[model samples]
Target: MATWSDFENAEPEMAEAGKKLLYQFGVGLAFLATVRKDGAPRLHPICPTVVNGRLYALIVDSHKRNDLRRDGRYALHTFPPVDVDDEFLVMGRAKLIEDPEVAEMVRKDQVARGMTSTNDELAFEFGIERAMHAKYPGGHGTWPPKYSIWKER
Candidate 1:
């Protein structure tokens, strides 16, 4: 597994495009897909955090959180645009951030941004396995948008 910083250092363009798509709305908004306990898929809206060259998401006490805790494997897709057919995706494994300092920093940032108030959230740093982006020049008219992909070696 490669950290976001590692991926960024290796494939700066791809990583930047992915990051742009993820935060296109000036905030973290994406569709997070995780495996449920029954081997099914669960999708949820998530606001991801990118700081200090790391991708993090705070999971509250909910089914989505449980899914991530039980199975770290996940797929995150950028939120759809109203007038564009472009897409960005990332697949990775999430590991809990056990370091108190790291977690506290993230928490403080979130609070400063008015994202969260309490520290009861679980912070997980994503380890990138693959990242990709598709750009459509003519919306759905384009059969296959130009695809750019990067995989950790």
Candidate 2:
């Protein structure tokens, strides 16, 4: 798996496009898919944060957190665009952020951006195995969109 910075370094344009889509709402909003204990999929709306070349999600104490803890596999899909058909996605393993300093910095940045409440929660950074972006020529009506994909070497 590669860090977000590594992905960006390898595919700058693709990474930037993905980032734009992920934060298109002026905040981070995505559909996070995690593996459940039963081997089914659990989907949740999530706000993701990119800080210092890393991608993180602060998860409260919930079933989603438990799912991630039990199985780190995850796929994050960017929220649908209102006027376009552009999409971004990343698949990876989520690793708990054990360093308090890193977690605190992420929390501070999220607070400054007014993206979340001041709550201490579990933080996980994604170790990306693959990333992809799809761009349509027009809106959703367009057919056969262009796709750009990257995978960890």
Best prediction by lDDT: 2
Candidate 2 residue lDDT tens string, 3-47 = 899999999999999888887887788999999999999999988
Best candidate per TM-score, number? 2
What TM-score, to 2 decimals, does candidate 2 have? 0.96
Please, what is the TM-score per model? 0.91, 0.96
Q: Per-model C-alpha lDDT, please?
A: 0.84, 0.89
lDDT of 1 by residue, 1-153 (tens): 988898899889878888878877766778999999999999999878778988888878889888888899999899877677788888999988899899888777666655754568889888889998888888666767889898999
Instruction: Estimate candidate 2's RMSD in Å.
Output: 0.9
Clashes of 2: 0
State the displacement of the C-alpha of residue 65, model 1, in Å, after optimal TM-score superposition: 1.0
Query: Model 2's lDDT to the true fold?
Result: 0.89
